[model samples]
Target chain A: MRALLIRDLRLAMRAGGGFGLGLAFFLIVVVLVPFAVGPDTSALAVIAPGILWLGALLSCLLSLDRILALDWEDGSLDLLATSPLPLEAVMGVKAVVHWLTTGVPLVLAAPVLGILLNLPSQGIIWIMLSLGLGTPALSIIGVFGAALTVGFKRGGLLLSLLVMPLYVPTLIFGAEVARRGSQGMAVETPFVMLAGITAGSLALMPIACAAVVRVNLR
Target chain B: MKQETMDTLLSVHELSVARGGLSILCDVSFDLFPGQALVLRGRNGIGKTTLLRCLAGLQPVLNGTIDVGADAIAYASHADGIKSMLSVAENLRFWAQVFGTTDIETALVAFDLVALRDRMAGTLSAGQKRRLSLARLVVSGRPIWALDEPTVSLDQASCLLFAQAVQTHLDAAGAAIIATHIDLGVNGQVLQLDPYAATSNTGVPSGFDEAFL
Candidate 1:
């Protein structure tokens, strides 16, 4: 499992691996919001938390197909399936690595991008916190979607279509947490809900992903 | 009979396999012993690859039984499973690590990939890539090898090298089942798949409405 993780990270970092593409997409979305919504500071501040959460969610979506599609394309998934490591472990490692490479960076970059949207002073940390907690669920769920669609040609759009609906709970709870925190409202409920979703998906989704991957391999 | 049963590495009895819901090979049976190789011979699309995949546990068998230990087999399909971004050495090391083996030196030397070890896999020629893919079998350290069309892009010399590798494996009490056309000069029994070909049309329905047919 460690070897699979290391290989995936290396693959992502290599040229044409789509390593920084998600982060760049996140940056573009954050930067474009102020222009699209006009330069009204109060208006931007009102929507900053929601916009940031949506940006992070969409960025996570951008790389979902890559989690297993590369391995599936090169037949590494088939070989890995026959290895000593179980497919469940492989899916778990893929989710962790995806979070590390894509999710962690987006979480860290959220605060910096928050400034561009005139985010309220208090909301910065909460937005970052919500994203940090929410993106794991995104990665895990996205991997499931990747596994489900790995066998199809031009699966990217279908992957997005499949994963976006699953992202709703995390997005709603996450954006709500950020929004409430920014307004100095009670945040414990939504924050806990977001964390619960992340924890639950992290626990259960890898098995589902592995099962679907086996079917796809067949 | 007792000695043969004790030495048998893999045994398939009345195995039937399908692809995309179409039965391809039926009532196929074979037994493999240590220090032996079985070459599967058939025309194209005769279900050789599907049979190998079934033996390797990559896909489920449609019918019958394949008796082999779960972790004792290693499969090498046509895809090579090579990551283009990593170097040849890196590719071998990754598999070695996954299979929990420490010796990649032998594999690199065996495949004559030591010179190309540092070069990224994407940069290698087709034959070189095929060699690297075969090297993975050595790193795998599994006793039973299930290979499908493993010599697609190899030259005469490389084919001989592969045959030698199989010979060495057999000598070391390992076994292999290969699906190939050209003879690699290795002394192995041939299993012709034509006799087991399914008589029914096992392909996808001609049209959506053909479901009734």
Candidate 2:
């Protein structure tokens, strides 16, 4: 398990078309939001949470296919299926690696990306906090999606279609908390709910992902 | 001295696999022993790959459990199982890490892929990719190898390389079940199947091609 984690992290870091592409995609998403919504600070502040959440959500969507596709293509998935490591541990290691390479950097950079959208300084902390708590759920859920489409030829579009609906609640609650926190409204309920969603998904998604991977690989 | 010469490393009993109302393999039984190899020979649309898939546990058995005993195993099919986007070394490193091994460089050398070590697997020619995938098994060093057409894209030299590797593996008392059309030098036990032997509920096409539904 330790080896799996270390290896996945190294692959994500060393592999081309990963972090740099993900970062560029995230930047493009953040930069494009104000153009669509207009440059009004009030509008930007009001939508900052939504924009950040949406950007985070889409960026995660772009990378979710990475979860198992590489392993599946490389035949490592078969070795893993036969190995002593239970499939659940394999999915867990994958999720942890995804979170580390994709989720952490996105969280760290959210506030800066928020600035490009003219988001208020007060909301910066909330955006970072909500994303930190929320993006792990995205990675976890994304694994299940990736697993379901792991063997399909045109799985990228299929994966998005399958997992986007599932990601709705997280997007809503994450944006709600960030928006409320930015607006100086009472933000406790939404924050707790988002955390609950994150925890629940983290607890359940890896098992689900493993099952889907088994089905797809077969 | 009673029954001390059982060569089988894998034993299958009454195995059947079905998918979505289509029965693929039925009541197929076979045994594969150490220091021996089995060739699952059949025509296209026959259950050759499906049977291999079933044995690898990639596909579930509807009616049987394969007894593989307590030994390590590796499977490589025509899927080229290596990720195309990764460099040869990165690909090897990934599998080595996953399979809990550290001798990836030596495996690459054995497969003669050391020169292409830094090249992305996606760019390699068919034979090179095939060789790289085979190298993964070298790093795995498992007791059992379930390979489906491991020579699909290999030139004569690489095929010889693969044949030598399989011989070396079996010489170490390991077992292999290869599903291929061409022979692999070693005298292999043939498990030939006639896809037309499948009997349908209607009972009219037991041996007829039109009854192949």
Candidate 3:
């Protein structure tokens, strides 16, 4: 698993369009929301959770296609598939790598991005914590979606369409928790619910990804 | 040659597979014995690769079963199965780690690719890429090796080198199921599938004959 993680990091680093591009994209999203909403701190503060959640979600989507497509094209995926390492373990490793590349970084950057959008100071913590817990589920579920669509030529668009719907519940609860916390409302219940979505997706997504990969291989 | 009994390494019974609402292969069955090699031959569009995939558990047998015995096996295809972004050595190292091996230098030397080890797999020429992929199988240390068109992009020298590797593996009582157009330089049973046999009601022509001797 460590080998797989190190290998993925090396590939992403060498691939040249990595952390910089993701950070730049996140910056654009953060900057653009203020333009779309005018310089109204009232409006931005109210919608801050939605804006942050949506920005992180879109950034997560941007990297999803690479999760398997690169490996599939170069034949590394097939070699990994045939190895004694079970597909579930491979999926687990892949999800962890995806999280490391996209999710954790986005969480660390969310506060700055959130503040830029004139978010409430109290809500900044909620945005960071919710995303920290929530983005992992997105990566895991996105992996399964990516596997299903890896074979199609125009799979990236299709992958987004398919996975976005599956992500709604997580998004809803995640944004809701952040929204409540920003308003100084009760946050534990919604936060727990968001964590449930993450935990449930974590348990289910790898198996689903493995099953989808088997179908795609066939 | 004296008749010597060998333990069955792989057993496939009445295997079938379907795709796009049509059966691609049906009732396909074969046994692989220790130290024995099997050549799967058929024209393009036939189910040769499909059978290999089924045996490797890459594709599901729509019906029936495949029981792979205790021996470890490796499957290589025309895909070369190496990550193009990674250097050849990195690719081999990843596989070695996954297969629980620490030594891959010998495998690299055997395939004559030690010099190209640092080159990105995508940058290697066709023959070099094929050799790198084969080198993986060499270091894998599995007793059963299944290859699909392993010689597709290989040059003459590398082709001969691959044959030697297979010869050595077979000499050590390993088994192989190879799908190829060219010969693998080993005396083995040939199971041929007539591309048209499934369309017509005619019995499949078993391609094994005296020349296989």
Candidate with top DockQ is: 1
lDDT of 3 by residue, A96-189 (tens): 9888888888899988888888888898899889999999999999898899887777799999999999889889999998899888999888
Q: Is the docking of candidate 1 incorrect, acceptable, medium or high quality?
A: medium
Please identify which of the two predictions, 1 or 2, would achieve the higher lDDT against the true structure.
Answer: 1
Task: Give lDDT tens digits, candidate 3, residues B158-202.
Answer: 889998888888888898899989986777899786632244333
Per-model TM-score of chain B: 0.92, 0.84, 0.84
Candidate 2 regions with alpha-carbon error over 4 angstroms: A6-16, A73-76, B1-7, B201-213
What lDDT would each prediction earn against the true structure? Answer: 0.90, 0.80, 0.81
The predicted structure with the larger lDDT, 2 or 3, is 3
Clashing pairs in 1: none
DockQ: the better of candidates 2 and 3? 3
Docking class of 3: acceptable
**Candidate 3, superposed: residue stretches over 4 Å from native:** A16-20, B1-6, B14-21, B24-29, B62-64, B199-213
All candidates in order of DockQ, best leading? 1, 3, 2
Q: Which ten residues in a row have the lowest lDDT in candidate 1 chain A?
A: A209-218
Worst 10 residues of 3 chain A by lDDT: A15-24
DockQ of each: 0.60, 0.36, 0.38
How far in Å is the alpha carbon of B42 misplaced in model 1?
0.7
